[model samples]
Target: MESAIPAHLTVERTRPARKSTSFRPPYPSFSARFDPSVRQVVMAYFGVQHRSATPPPVVSEALAHLASVGGGVNRERAQYVDEAGYHTTVEIRYWTDPAEFSSWLADNDFWTAWPAVPDAGFFLEVVRPTVPRFETLFSNDRLEGVAVAADGLSGEIQEHGYWGGARDRIPLAQNDLLAPIGDVSARTVGDLVTVVPNGNLCLIRSGQEWTETAGDERQMYLTEVEPVLRAGMDFLRDDGLSVGCYANRYLRVLAADGGVTDKSFGLSWWRGLEDLETWSESHPTHVAIFRAALKYLSTMGPAARLRLYHEVTVVEPDQTRFEYVGCHPRTGLLRALG
Candidate 1:
């Protein structure tokens, strides 16, 4: 769907974390995991507007109620996402009945009830929802690595971080898979994916896996073990490890039109990528070991490959500076996004 917000004010971004070109569902798409009970979605773009007098509590309450106001059966999750320097301070997003949009305004008393926040330079924020008219172009899913030991806390830890907007958690610990990547490229990306109190993101790992023969049980087991995921989490639990650039997955759940894969995506987000080094110095231990495992597995045989993608969003500036369209620095052509 075309965006309802004006073109100039919207801040668009992308990630390079998703690259699952290898392992796709045997069918065109996977079966739907969560039943589609909530059909309508609403996206709210939030800005600081009046930082001094703005009532954070009131705003918070309004957001909380917005989820249930529409009344759907599907587990409607609400998340707030923000990227530093982006025009919008926060983006409160959710899905449910479209009709409730009116109720959201009335119950919240948005008319005159908005915190007597300043009006002059309110920093101007916008909240608009737009569904993709065509299909979405990405896929996302949560694959639990090997959950070796049941800390009984894995679920809680994941929930906490998932809700907190801490996009990726490996690099801080120097995940096992980092050395091969960081050492080889250490290339920095100018993008990031952050989760707010209620936001979420996704990851992707793909490359030519060794072809399965009639009988080849001698494959590397550590990389495919289930406990590894928990191991990664445990590493995150620990404080320090080595420092290096790590890869973080980015997931944006736009309406997919089956451009990439012929399979249906699950409760996942569109794919994107991020470099751990660009934001911080170190990575968690579990992450370090985990990444290493991936690299080692890559060496074994089948060429593990998953291309990454991401986005850099900024406000519309003067038309003169509007560039990058078809203007290839090398060939100098005006080919832009269709």
Candidate 2:
């Protein structure tokens, strides 16, 4: 069989050019205070998958419950047939009081009901981070992510350097990186993994937009493009690639009315810049997918209603924090510790 990857798409990888360090922070004092009341955020991923074509009914009901009733749940992004070949949905929820979230988790009925569904597997990761430990950036003014869940933060990080010059701007305790925050945990339906954030982290927030008449273009992505992308992710996760990638998630943006939208965002967690670049440039799977995606976009032409964009931010270890509650044995930051 001929390979799906085109020959033109295969290109040699090269190192990026070094840049001069002439740029400096334009502001002398740039620091934001956190509101005392804003304690933590519960970032949860609820995923389900089955070998059969259709998922169990309980899976749908569980997702609907998360969308409809969960308090402190503010923003949700859903996706289907992810790299793991599972239907996954993530929600960035805020907690004025951590006890409320704990109360909901203590309820065992939902947990018992899900696993009993035949041939189904469900996983959940609830990450709680202190308000002051992480930084965020948004391309649009609309409040989202940490912004929706927390208060007392600066708007848009405008510092220079890969770490966002975060060390200078934000204060850190001596043992923040090595020490675990008591509140964070990760869990599957069966087991809960206790984990902590250990080192530097990077989050890439990227999005795509499509024109109104681009309904067909959207379908093309769902039918043709997304599978290849998901496959590449599976390759990364299962086969392994460059050393530093910790986790990657692709989420479909949901409209205010709880319907899926043309837009989607990807949250990729990395150990450092070099590993991320190595995978992006030299990984055979990524290169092929990149080429195919480009070809598809170009074939659509200027009249096409599709547009894509993304932004990357490197977060310092102290500037970011992660705690996993009831996560599986190896998930997220726990993968490294395990």
Worst-scoring 10-residue span by lDDT in model 2: 1-10
How would you encode candidate 1's per-residue C-alpha lDDT over 1-338 as one tens digit per residue?
Answer: 12211133223323221222232222111111112343324332222221223335544454444434442222212121211111112222323344564465456433223343222111111112221110111111222111111111111111111111123222111121221211111111221111111011112212121223122222343235224533443332221112221111111222223122211111111111223222222345445544654555455433332221111111111100111111111100011110
Q: State the lDDT at 309 in candidate 1.
A: 16
The digit string of per-residue lDDT tens for model 2 on 68-127 reads 765664655666444435555455554545567778667632532444454555555444
Off by over 4 Å in 1: 1-41, 44-93, 109-113, 118-338
Residue 330 error, candidate 2, Å: 9.1
- C-alpha positional error of residue 309 in candidate 2 after TM-score superposition, expressed in Å: 10
TM-score winner among the candidates? 2
* Alpha-carbon runs more than 4 Å astray in model 2: 1-36, 107-113, 150-157, 160-241, 256-259, 269-338
Lowest-sum lDDT 10-residue window in model 1: 329-338
State the displacement of the C-alpha of residue 87, model 2, in Å, after optimal TM-score superposition: 2.9
Whole-structure CA lDDT of model 1: 0.23
User: Model 1 — TM-score against the truth?
Assistant: 0.25
lDDT of each: 0.23, 0.49
